[model samples]
Target: MTGHVTKPGRALRRLLAPLAAHAILIAATAVMLLPLAWMVSTSLKQSGIGLSRGIEWLPWRDAWTNGKETVDVMVLGARVAPGDGGEAVEVGIKSLASRRRFTTVYVPEGAFEAEIEAWRIRPLTGEDETAEARWAPFASVRRRVAPEWGNYREALEKMRFWVCLANTLAITFLGTAGTILSCSLVAYGFARFRFPGNNVLFLVLLSSMMLPSVVTMIPVYLLFRELHWIDTLLPLFAPAWFSVNAFAVFLFRQYYMTLPFDLDDAAQIDGCSALGTYWRVLLPLSRPVMATVGIFCFTHYWLDFMGPLIYLNTSEKFTLALGLYTFKGAYTTQWHYLMAATLAVSLPCIVLFFAGQRFFVRGVVMSGLKA
Candidate 1:
């Protein structure tokens, strides 16, 4: 009698549960996207003057320089390995000295001494060379001062923003594609194949998922440098070929593990090879999981700043994140322009996540079910 009485109430909840869940999801989405909204708002705000005083959301100047003025040179250093073409060496008068211009020049990785030598060797007429010596390392250099807008404009014009964008997009597309193909194949093998030490090997792969990136970065960098890939995008995209992202493989494996054994048996009976069975049958049914994996890979690589920062040495190879970092001076930052560039770079990823959220959720839930 009690069970019968409770059944109607349970039915009512089943009818209402989806609506309630949707409401909660809407609230969560709002919370998640609010920061993004604010970022966009800040990016469009106008640059105002007197930055020292405060920020205003209108185009203006901030204490424009009166005339040629001298600024001190400050150097930041990091130790590098010998024979890496990076060591302090002597130049006659000017030393690379880490940085020359307070605003634009930051020699993150290079021999400061060699930089000084390179600059010193450049031809200068009598008075011009005297002026060059005045601006030389270990001396105060004066130059015509202007507004920060010049820096922003120079960066916009000189920096390979479009080239970097292309490189980044290529890396994102190719890397994600390779990761999906390789991880899916290896994952399906692990899910269905019977072989020696398979369980132990899967465990080892799972353990690798817990390893931090910092542990592998230097060794990977050294390996790439030896391969002559240090300054290229190949280093960025090549790892996906081998299924190095253990987490993605694990995700796909978990999803594949739930597939009915009967399906593979039927394929075998139909004269299908193992790879043929997977390509023809399993892939069509794995859309949700594939979308989930694609979204994850896309988001991870799209926002990657560190890898490109370390490997790309030239301005032409700058990713959006590294390019944005240039808006900031050592002592001050152009907050307005920085914020603008930040929002510009983040919008595409935001659009992608929202478009794929439905598949992401469904894949996550269904993949966890044990058959």
Candidate 2:
């Protein structure tokens, strides 16, 4: 009787468990995506002005520069006292058109001039028309918002953005290709071949992953310098060709090991060599893992800052990661341009990851199942 009553409770828990998990996942995703959404918002925003004011979740249709302005001018025909005015106070034509309000003007700080006098504007029909001038800023300002699409154009124009983009793409493509080819070959050897001390060698490779990259930084830099690879992209992508990434090789090896060894034996029985077996029999089945590794390698190379900073010397050869530094200076930061350039740089990676997401998930799951 108790078991029958418990069955319904178990069923209810099973039904609610997935829903609760999904709700938590949705909240986590939103938290992760908030910064990215804000970055996109800032990319579309106008410029450096008003950034310190507050947070803006959404980009405005147009950013308008609206504020009180004070300007220096010569106040002419001023009355000495109330009801004793011999001549009315006059404002110069220069002051009337002092602002470039015809177009949306962004005055970060008010105007500076060689000469200025605070002049008050009085209504013609007011009782104080004949009174002495009182200094105050007027509200005869026209405010408007114009489309800030120029932020993109300005960001591009400010730096060699196209060059950085091209360099990044070239490096990413070469690094991904090299990593796939080399790591897959290494993974195949580790998964299939039987050699003396093979397991020991593989253990050493995995242990290397525990060493911090900083330990090898100086030696790697000196080696590259000796090879005259510094200041060139060779320092960035050449390492990928050596299967130096233990984690990627480990992932590929695990995935490869999950396949039945019967396929290799069958290929050998058909007079196919070891290399032939890997190419014809195993490579075709490895697409999912290949995609996962490619995606990881692409993103790593694309967003890699420290490597590019250490190796690259010239501005023309800079990657997008290094190009961002141009937007920041000793005293000022161009938040809009920085965000815009960042968005432009990251868009390709974002698209690639989303497009290959299914393959990536399948590869990770299959790889982990075996190892």
RMSD in order of candidates: 17.5, 9.1
Candidates' lDDT values, in order?
0.63, 0.70
Which ten contiguous residues of candidate 1 have the minimum total lDDT? Answer: 57-66
Measured against the true structure, the TM-scores of the candidates, in listed sequence, are 0.61, 0.71
lDDT of 1 at 19: 94
**How many clashing residue pairs, candidate 2?**
2
> How well is each residue in 4-75 modelled by candidate 2, as lDDT tens digits?
999999999999999999999999999999999888777776453324335755443311212444332222
Q: What residue pairs clash in candidate 1, if any at all? A: 49-61, 49-62, 50-62, 95-116, 96-116
What lDDT would candidate 2 get against the real structure?
0.70
Instruction: Give the best candidate by lDDT.
Output: 2
Off by over 4 Å in 1: 1-38, 50-159, 327-332, 360-371
